[model samples]
Target: MAPLMRNRSPNNVPNELNVEYYRQRASAGLIISEATAITEQGQGYSNVPGIYTDEAVEGWQNVTRAVHEAGGKIFCQLQHVGRISHKSLQPFGDPPVAPSAIQAKAKSFVVYSDGTSDFIETSLPRHLKPFEISGIIEDYRRAAARTLEAGFDGVEIHAANGYLIDQFLRSSSNQRTDLYGGPLENRARFMFDIVGCISREIGPGRTAIRLSPVAPSNDVHDERPQALYNYIASQLSAYDLAYVHIVEGATGGDRTYQQGPEPFDYAEMRETYYRTDGSGAWMVNNGYDRPLAIEALEKERADLICFGRPFIANPDLVRRLRINAPLNALDQRTLFGGDAKGYTDYPVLGG
Candidate 1:
């Protein structure tokens, strides 16, 4: 299952509602939890769960325990939204941090005191100092450690979606001249550092990462995506990660969208990883249906397929796919910041 932010954790702590939610979908072989904040500084959307605080960890403990008890393996997706966040979401209303001070052409979800929320323009961000970078990396390390404490089967670093890690990797977002921003290698330093740290904290076999090479989600782009991501795939060979999850094309949009002059070749990226001895499972996501997913596996293009929204409306998505049953229609009005009405209330085949 793909990570989909339901924004139901009012205090950044998963509640009983959350535990029941995951337990219902425990049929999924592996469920990737929603993008979870690694620190207060990493939060972007309102009500999204966090992994830093003791309460947050305790909240996730319930989630993982329920999933495990129901026979499901789950991974927590650690995330830092960087400049994609608004000051309202940041600690003490401070400006969000980014690779550069540039603001993203994006919006963030903010809930007002009146119990209402709306998407607001992301605030201008402050450039991250060299010293601050290490602190954030440490935050990721701590988050990874917390995942084990919370009883997660593994963890996936949210390096995609124009978040903090993705902000550092994209040339358009990163303008630093230091060891973290010029060439492809420099731009990828932050990612590798986080991956290495997490792998050390939790074995690489339990560590994975999600990347969106060509997806222009959160308004991020690199001059040479093909070259940049190909290099990343090769470098990833060093860590025998659990898997490499790639978001193909525009996230939640066009599946054939290209971010550069040349069309991004996902097959080439996988080949590069394999040639360089990266032996991780290759997972692909983005507008996939049963036919497309089967075609990918049959053609040996992907080892696993991720369904995001489909899982939102179908708690028994695994069985639905297996039997080729018609899926429940997603309620557009209740996609985020909602109760069980559109969440765990979705009926299954016989329930």
Candidate 2:
């Protein structure tokens, strides 16, 4: 599994709590925690962690402490789901808001009162105004502040995977005609603003951003991804933040639409952020292995690698890599929005 960081899970776990899980895999140069909702309104799935609560701050503090004790650095990934959420997942049963009123074609995975599973299609999003947009930025800033309070090394703004930020980044999903949409710069303005706010809250050195330029998951489509992302990279460089994480393959779902006579070259897309200013670090995720990770690092394509499923089954992933041990296969059945069955039940190597 490449980009080893999995999506968010419930903050509370058994013996393998957030602290233990992170400490176990502390050998990784950087451990990006699962997607953390910026606010209750930002949450798309039930039981996922939130950075906005006092209890969550304490829980993540334990996680950061454990990773630090094991000599590892950790980054908190901030996620905000806009139209991709159901009323059940929203705050006070409020409808999820987005840049436009468009409803995402995707369904959100949620748990019922009976503990059964179901998928609910997204409802019409409340088209946000300029003032509401400012509130969203504040939400991100507050989450960043809480992350700092939790003792994380840094924060990664989740602007990919068809979430709230991705909705604004993609032209097809974002039909706004205001300064917050339309052109690439305007489309990217919200992200940049968020970066600025978070930087102010936690400092630029401890800030990072994740972007999926070519991956069209969540019905996100842009006429010119290369141009749009190039512009984004160029703009992001001015901030001199921590790093930029890019998801290279088809994120969220299978690839169905054909680009052209040739498939999108991930290497070329990698160059956009890697060469933007040469100041910030670059991380490449999605379907990467040991050899490819080392190659990307050696070729300077990516400074750090993220592994998702591999870490799920092998907590001692760094040690396994050092000893060339085989990794346990991930159980897809228990992947998303589940309990301890696959969350932390995987035994450590030789344990």
Candidate 3:
């Protein structure tokens, strides 16, 4: 897993494509890099890696080579933070840009030169016009082209976690009445269009996307989570993408609220996207252990499973699962906005 944007360190253990790190966890069928910014304005926090730059592409290419040398497959997650950014994080003190000008209620982690972390309020974004919106789609295409140049197995478009795509998908955030909003199809249009553009840059078989149905992270709420995601899944079915990853629980909220009774169930939600008729592969994430992951795969609910904190604490996660070995616990304090202390220092089993 790629580290969160703001949680990066100057050492760049997580964001940097290091040989040792990828060598350790090369067992995963496919390792998706942490959310990568599509542009400088797409950044949400300090030090989150960008895919738009030649240097960034070179850095990630080193990572891809490392993983590939170790017999591992990897994908880069293309992300745009939308309004979930602080002015301090933007280039030249520019404000964050989004589908709307509203400010996200979430606080981004800010790191200091001393390696300390603090929460900072997100800046209000400048709402994009029709022309600017088209520009953003081009941004995604460029980012996807870079990912292909970097030699990654594929690219996972991060439409989840209250980012740019999510901002347009949710009714609570998108209040526009134009062709880009007001109806479910219009809201999903931006995503589908971006996907189509990116697919042209890279083959559709090498493209993927991640979505969250009921996640209330970053203060995002939808009027109809079920219908919204159902339509999204159905619409996405037209593309011959690699797979779709879904975060099952509230990705950016309290665990209690996420596990509570909600209109959408995680298993049922997975079924919406991963049908047996072979629409595409489906990957399920959030709070999954070996047992739960195996169960999901057994029941055909998920084709692959992504483990976040578990992978952080256990670099040999695939081996641990294969042998049913004991797992390590992650240090929550160092989860975000940290150096390599908890980022790359997590030990492999018996190491």
Candidate 4:
């Protein structure tokens, strides 16, 4: 299962609702939890779960235990929103930190005390200093350690979706003239640093990463995406990662979105990783249905296929796909912050 954010974890801690939610979907081959904040400062959306504090770790323990009891393997997706955040969600209302001071032309989810929540313009951000960059990398390392302590089988780094690591990877978001910017290698430094740290913390065999090479989600852009991602793929070959998940096309939109002069090459990137000795499962996501998924696997286009929205309303999605059963429609209203009305209440094939 792909990581889909449902802002139901009030106070950024998982609860019984989350435990039941994952337990229902335990039939999946592997379940990647929603993008979880590594620290309070890494958060951008309200009511999302975190992995840093003792309380948050304990909350996740219940979740992992339930999933495991049901025979499911789950991974925690560690994330930091960086500039894709509002001051209201930052520590002490400070400006969000990023590779550069520029603000993203995006909105963040925020909930109010009156139980109201809405999307708000992301606040301006200050560029991260050298020391602060190291600190953030350290945060990822600690989060990976906590993930295991919380009973998770593995950790998936949320380096895509215009978050902290994505901000550094794209040229449009990073304009610094320091060691961490300018050249493609320099822009990619931050991502590699985090990958190295997390791999060391929780062994590369349990370390995975998600990337949207050309997706323009969260207003991030690049002059040459093909070159950038191919380079990233080649570098990732050095690590013995568990898997490499790629979001094909634009995030939740076009499956053919292009970002530069040359069209983004998904196959080329995968081949690059393989050619460079990348020993990881290649997981492909975005806009997949039963037939499409079957075709990809039959053609050996992917090692694993991940379905996001279909799994949201179909906890028995694996069984449904096996027998070609119909899927349940998603309740758009309860997709974000809400109670059980649209969550675990979704009916199964014979419920």
Candidate 5:
């Protein structure tokens, strides 16, 4: 929901609308919240929820309580937008931070100070100073702590969708010559370290991460896509995260986006995860439909499936999919920032 711009406090905290929104959709077996900011620098857009404040924690407590009452499991997605931000959205107008100093080719989803949404051209980001990296890792750990305090089943580290983690993981975006760049092993160090830290804070069994092997969004690319992802799966095998959520193709792109890089090992990454001796559940996402999801599970391609857009208008999505019921066409106009008109007003099947 990208925060829904629904805070009455100075901090962008979730309110009752956020609670009721999740409550209404509690039929979902596992609800992964929208990518939430872990720090002010990470709050890349207007009104997204923050986990660093007391008010934010209490607000989330209400949401978790509601979802639990409805018998649904939820995981908070911790995301740091890094360079995909505008000066207006940054902390004290600081230049957005990335692994290196580079301007992304894509535009940012910006909400101006005057409360207007616009696609602004991304600005050049400053290379992260070595001193700042440790603090960012702490940010993830603290945010994961808050996720547990909010009574979530676990936390999903947002290492996908060309965000900060993806920026560091890909060779094109990360030109840092220090320990963070050059070799594939070094490029993935940031993710491994952050994951290790977060997992340490909130038991590895309750810590999870999402990654995209070859997503090109936000001007991200890698010379060895398969190598990077395989390394990721292998390294993560050492830690028993709740799951390794993978976007089967370019994140949120076509379902048949691609079969992987040359040599196209369709299930190589999957095999790599299993090689960990059943380290964690394997999840597949990106443009998945109901039938495809079932087929993938039946074929043992995935342990769980993540459906994105379908849950927008269908609060009773589970029942609808189970019985082949019709779905509501979510009005896109009210998607980004809105009140009850679109957020909490989506009717259930018989409600």
Candidate 6:
């Protein structure tokens, strides 16, 4: 559900609201938790949760316990918004880090330096040090371990929406002469290394990745997305991940203007992954309603379909879709920071 930015605590601890929220929607077979930061440095927006602290771990454990008790499976999405941040969001007023010092030609949700929380233009970031890069990888490793400890079924590494990993994969964001940048293979090396490390640290079957090949989100773009993702999927085939979730077109935006003018073929990408020995579930997201989801499933376009907006107001979304029931419109005003008015008051069927 988009509009999940409920910055309730400085430490970003999950509370009763979180547990109740997930529990109410437990009917959704696989409930992927919202994107969470791995470390304080990974935080981008205010009030989002993290898995790096004792309070965070304890809080998410409560959420997991609730979901599991309700007979639901959930995965925690680990995300690090690279240059998609501002000084007010970073620790000690440090600039956000990226593969290159280039500022994203995009805006981010941030607490302005003047002390107001709002969506503003992203600030320029400094290049990460070689050692800092390794440190970030270690953070990811620890984050995965923490998620497992908190009793999550698995984790989906966030590599979409112009986040940390996406910046590295797209040449428009990464203009470095080092091994971590330049050619597509080099640009993609960081993701493989992180995925390989996490999979090894936390078992491949329990790890997954979310990617947006041609979305160009967060001011990131590639000259050849088809070749880029073909290589990525083909290379990913070596790992035994649970699945690969792709954001078709863009992440949480206009569905009509999808994949840009030249969209990469999902069929070709799937073929490449399978052809290269990739063995995992394939998931597609973005602009899916019940009818489209059913069609995609029937046509075998995807193994799983993720619905974002629908879940915001429909706790019994799975049942609603199954029976073709009407959905409730989301209250846009209560989307970001709010109490339980629109957050948890949305009625289920017959509620």
Highest lDDT model number: 4
What is candidate 4's lDDT per residue for 38-96, written digit by digit as tens? Answer: 99999999999999899999999999999999999999999999998999999999999
**Model 3 spans with C-alpha error above 4 angstroms:** 1-6, 9-19, 113-115, 252-262, 265-279
Write out the backbone clash pairs for model 2: 3-306, 3-307, 3-308, 4-306, 4-307, 4-308
TM-score of each: 0.98, 0.91, 0.91, 0.98, 0.94, 0.94
Candidate 5 residue lDDT tens string, 151-180: 888888898877899999988899999998
Candidate 2, superposed: residue stretches over 4 Å from native: 1-16, 252-277
Tens-place lDDT per residue, model 2, 1-351, is 233333334542212355666677787788887778888888787667788878888888888888888888899989898888888787788888998988878878777767777777878788899998999999999889888888988898999878888899888888999999998889888988999999999999999888887676666777877777777876776787888887875764433233334455556655554444567777777766678778888887777787776777887787787788888898877776555567667877779
Per-residue lDDT for 160 in model 1?
A: 95
Q: How far is candidate 6 from the true structure (C-alpha RMSD, Å)?
A: 2.2
Query: Judged by lDDT relative to the true structure, which candidate is superior, 2 or 5?
Result: 5
Q: How accurate locally, in lDDT, is each candidate?
A: 0.93, 0.77, 0.78, 0.94, 0.80, 0.84
lDDT of the structure predicted as candidate 2: 0.77
Instruction: Report the candidate with higher TM-score, 1 versus 2.
Output: 1
Worst 10 residues of 1 by lDDT: 271-280
Would you give me the overall lDDT of model 1?
Answer: 0.93
Q: What's model 3's TM-score?
A: 0.91
| Candidate 6 lowest-lDDT run of ten | 1-10
> What TM-score does prediction 2 earn?
0.91
Model 3: how far residue 111 lies from native, Å = 2.3
